[model samples]
Target: RRTVRAIAVACMLTSATTAVGLASLVVSKTVMLRHFGLTSGLGVMVSYVVIITFVPAVLTWVTPPKREEVRRERTSMFTKVSNGLVARLLRWRWAVLVATDLFTVGAGYVASGITVDHALLDQFDETDPVYTTTLLIEEKLAGVRPLEVVLVSTEEDHFMDPEMVQTIQKIRNWAALRPEIIRTSSYGDMLRESYVLLSGDPSVRSENFKSAKQVKGLVTMMSQRDPSPLNDWLTQDGKKARVQFKLRDVGAQATMRFLDALEQEIESELGDDETVSVSFTGEAYTASRGQAAVVNDLLGSLLVAVVVIFLLLAFFFRSVRLGLLSIPPNLIPLVATMAYMVWREIPLNVSTVIIFSISLGLAVNGTIHVLARFREEMHTGIGREAALVRAARGTGRAIVISCVTLMAGFSVLLLSSFVPVRNFGELIAITIGGCLVATLLVLPPLLSVAGGDGGVRDSSD
Candidate 1:
C-alpha cells in the first residue's frame, strides 16, 4: 500500500505539474486566437492538453510494477560509472558547479524588479509586413491605443453644463502631452475645432447647444469619420459623455502610465461623492491595464498553490525541514526566468505574465522526487553524503525523463506565429531546464548538508 501511494504521488506530481506549464503555453498562442477567434483556437488548446496529459498518465498507471526487474535487465558493468573522468567529477567536482548555480539564481532575483515596456512589434516583428505596417500606422499617425474613457453623471443637466464641457477639454489637453497617447477626441474638442473651422461662428461656439436640431447637425459632422467609436460612447439617456484616446501601440508601458494618471485625475476632479465618474473600456490601452489585474490574480493563484503544496508535503512526511527545503528550489526558477526577461528587454504582456504562476508547479516536481528519495535512503541508515548519491542515482532517471517530456511539450510552442507566445514558451522551457539541472545536480549536494535526518523541521509546522 505504501509503495503504491508513493508511485501514485510521484506520477501525479510529475504529470500534473508539467501539464500546468503546458496549459499556460496552450492558452497564450495569441496569433491563433487573433486569426481564428476564440471558438477555433480554444478548441485546439483543449484537445492538445487532453492528449498530452491523459495518454502518458494512463500508460504510467497501467504499467506493471517491475521497475526493479527492468533496472536489472537494462544495467551492464559500463552503466555503473566505476572509474571514468566523469565518475571522478561526480565524486568531487559537483560542489563548485552547485555554488555557481546558486549564485546565478541569487543574482537573478535582484535583476527582475526593474520593469521595462515593449515596443509595438516587440511582441511581433518589424520584419513581418503586417507588423511593419502596424508600426507605420503607430509612428506616422500617432494613434495606437484604442481606449475610450466615458464620463457619466446622474443629472441630465449636468452633462450639458459649461463646467462639464470644460472638464473634458482639460482632460484632453492633459492627455495630448504624453508621447504614447495618439490624441483625445471629445465633443468639446469637436466643438472648438469646428467653431474655428466655421469662421468663428457664435452659434456653433455655444458649449451646450440645447437646441436638438443644432446638436443633431453637429453630431452628423462628427460622425463623418467617427474615429473614436462615438456612438457607443454616448449614454443611453444622453446624460453621459465620453472621451476616446488611442495608444501609440498595444503593450506600451508609457500608455499604461498615462491612462493610470488620467484615471486618477478624473477621480480627483470629480470626487467619489458626486455622481460624476469616469469609466473605461474598448481599447488596447484598457486591455493593457487589465493585464496588471491579471498579474495580481495570477499571484493570488500561486499563493493558493503554495499553501496546498505545503499541506501535501506535511501530510506525506510529518516533518518540517524536508518541506522547507522544497520551497526555495521551486521559487528560484521563476525569479530567474523573470530576470532573464528583464535583461533581454521583454515586456510584461498577458501571455508572459502567467509563466511564473504555471512554472511554479512544474519546478516543484523534481524537488519532490529528489526529497522523497533522500528521506527513504536516510530511513535505511545511509550516511548523509552516501545517501545523497543513492538518492540521485535512484531518482535521477525519472526526474530526467519527466523534464525531457516537459521540455519537449513546451518546445512545441516555438512553432507559434505569435512572437510573444513563442518567446514565452522558449523562456519557460529554459526555466524548466534550469530547474531540472538544479534538482539533478545542485540540489543533491545541498541536501547532503541541509536535509539532516529528523533534525530539520518543516517551516510551516
Candidate 2:
C-alpha cells in the first residue's frame, strides 16, 4: 500500500505521456500507422489502470518484508557510495552542468546529418537469402522493379503516328544508355519488329517511316483475327501506350538519385507540350514518395508528443522550470537514438523515425518519479538539498530496476529477422540506458543548482 501510494501518480502520468506519443500516430498519413497508434495508446492506458488497481488489490493479501530488512537494503548502498555523494558532487555542479551542455551540443550536431529514404528489401539484411536472390535475379535476367511509363493522347490511334513512335524511341534509347535500367520494352519496339517481319524486306526500316499512314499500313497488313502482344501495350483505339522500364534494385541513395534524374529528364523531354504529361507510379517510386511523407508526418507526431508532454509536466508540478528541466533527460535520449542511427548506418526511414517520440515518452518516467518524490520530501520542511538527496536515494533503486526490466524487454527484439525491428530494439535500449544515466546522475545536480531552495513553495506562496 505504501509503495503503490508513493508511485501511482508518477506511473499514471508516465502512461499519459506514453499514450500521447502513441496516440499521436492518428495524424500519420499511413493507415497502418494510424491503427497502430490507436491500439498501442489504448493498451498503455489500460496497462496503467491494471498496474495501479490490480497490483494494489493483490498486495493487500501479501505480507510486507520487515522494516529492518528494508532499512538494511537502503542503508547498505549508502555506506559504500556515502550519503554525502550527492552534496559532494554539487560542490562542482557547475562543471557537471557545463559538460552536459557540451554533450548536448555534440549530439545535436550529429543528429542533424541523418538522411531519409525507404525500400522494401531494406527490411532484410544483405546476407539474407531474400536479399541475395533479389540481387541475383536483377543481375542475371532483368530488373525485377518495374517503372510504368504511360503516354496518353486525346486522339484515337494517336500512338500509331510515326511522330509518337519516334518520341517513344527517344525514351527507350535514353533508358538503354542508363546503367540503372536493365531493359526497356514498348509497342514501338513491337511495331518495328512486326513491320520488318511482314515486309519480308530487310531494307525496309522502322525509323524510316515518316507518317502515321506508313505505320498504319504495317498495322493493317496484320490480320485482325490474329492476336498480337502489341495489343496489350496499346489500347483498342490506341489512345494510351505503355512503356516498361525494368530497373536494377539499387540501394536507397542510388534509387532516389535515379528518380530525381528521371523527373528532370521527363520534364525536359516533353516540355511545353500540352498534349502529354508524365507522372510516376510503382512500388519503388511510391516508396520514394512515401519517404518525404514519413519525414513530415513523423516529425509532426514528434512535435505533438513533446508539446503535450511539456504542458502536462508544467501543469502537474505547477512549476514551468521543472517542466523545462524535464526536457534534457528526454532530449538527450532522443539525440542519442539519432546518433545511434547515424553510427549504425540506419537511415531515418519509415521503421526507425518513430523512435524519437517513443523513447522521449519513455525517458521522462524516471525524471518524473524523481521530481515527484522530491516534492513529497519537500513538504516535510526539509532543506532543498536534503529533499533532493532523499528523493534521489529513495527513488533511485526503483528507477534502476524498472529501467533494467524495460531494457531487457526491448533487447529481446534483437532476435527479430527484420533489420528495422532489430535496429529499433537496439536503439531503444541505448536510449533507455542514456535516460537512466541522465535521470540518476545528471538530473540531481540540475535540481540542486537550478531548482531553487524553496522548491514549489517559492512559487506557490
Candidate 3:
C-alpha cells in the first residue's frame, strides 16, 4: 500500500510539472506551437488522470493483499537487471562522470550550430505534388510567391504624374536587373507597353509620357478593355499603386536577404525624390516575420520553463541541491537532441525547437521518481548506497515503463505525411530514450558522489 501510494503521488507530481512546462508554449506566437502546446499539455493531464484513477483501482480489484505481497517478493527480470546495473554503475562512478562531462561538452558544441528554418518548402518532400507544381509554375509563368510593393502618392492624382510614373519605371528597371525577380507587373509595365504599341515607336517608352493628363488618358483607355488588369494594380482614387514581383522559388533565408536588398534599393532610388513612398507586403514577408517570432518565443519559453521547473523541484524536494542535481540529466538529452538535429541538417523550425522544453519536462519525470524513492528509503534509516540500489530496483522500473509508453505514443507521429511532424516524432523518441539512460545510469552515480548524506529530504515530512 505504501509503495503504491508513493508511486501514485510521484506520478501525479511529475505529470503536473511536465504539463506546466508544455502549457507555457501556448503563449508562443506561432500557430503550430500554440496547437502543439495545448494538445501536449492536455495529453499530460489526461495521462495523469488515467494512470492515477484507473491503474490502482484495477490493481486493488484483482490482486488481494497476499497476492500483492507475493508479487512484490518475486523479482521481475527488469528489477533484477536494474539492480545489477545500479551496482556496477556505483563501482565505475568516477569513469561514468568523466564520460558524461565529455559527452555534454561535445553535444553542446554541436547544438550551438542548430539554426531556425521556417520555409514552407522545408516542410514538404521534394517529390510532393505541391512542390512539383510550384516548380512547374515557376518554369512556365510567374513564380507563386508574390512580393507586393505598394507605392503611395503624396498627392490625390499624383499616381498619373509624370515624375511619379518615372520613379515607378526606374524602380521596375532596377528590379529587372535582378535575376531573383522572375517577373514584375506594375502600372508602369502596362503604360510602357501601351506606349510602344500605340506610338509605333519602341524608343517612346515609359518616360515618354508628357504629363499627368496624358498618363490619365492612357489609364482610362486601358481600363476600358474587356478585362482591366490595371484595376488590380491601381487604386480607385489613383493614390496607391502596386508593383507585384513574382520571385523564383528561393528558400526562406535567401528571400529575406533579397527583400532587404530590394528595400535598400527602393530607398536609394526614391529617398531624395519625394513623389512617392514605398512599403512591402506579401507571403514572403509574412513568413519571414513568423520565423523571427518563433525564434524569439523559443528562447523566452525555454528559459521560463527551466527556471519554473527548477524552482518547483526545489520546493517539492525541500532541498535545492536535489533540484540542481536533476538539471544535468535533463539538459543532456536536450543538447543531444539538438546535436542530432545539427548532424542531420534539420533546422530547428516551429515544431522542433519546442522539443527542448518538452524533453526537459519529460526527462525530469524519471529523476523525480527515482529521487523521491531514494529519499523515502533514506527516511527509513537506509544508507545512501543501499537506498540508491533499492530506488533503482523500485522506481527505475516505473520510469522505464513510463518512458516506453511515451515512446510508443510519440511514435505515432512517424506515420504523418508532414516532414516536420515526422522529424519531431523521431527526435522526441531519441530524447526519451536518452533521458532514460541518463536517469538510470548517470543520475544515481551523481547522487552518490555529490549528495554526501543523500541531499534529498521528503517535503511532506
Report lDDT per candidate.
Answer: 0.64, 0.80, 0.82
Number of colliding residue pairs in each model: 8, 0, 0
lDDT of 1 by residue, 139-245 (tens): 78755557778777777646545566666677777778777677667876665566557666655554544454454455556567646334654542557888878
Report the lDDT tens digits of candidate 2 across residue range 212-233.
8877766665536478566667
Q: Best candidate, lDDT-wise?
A: 3
- From the highest TM-score down, the ranking of the candidates is 2, 3, 1
**How many backbone clashes can be found in candidate 2?**
0
Error of 2 at 169 (Å): 1.5
Candidate 3 regions with alpha-carbon error over 4 angstroms? 64-77, 202-210, 223-228, 236-238, 452-461
TM-score, each model?
A: 0.71, 0.92, 0.89
Q: How accurate locally is residue 184 in candidate 2, as Cα lDDT from 0 to 100?
A: 86
Model 2 RMSD vs true structure: 2.4
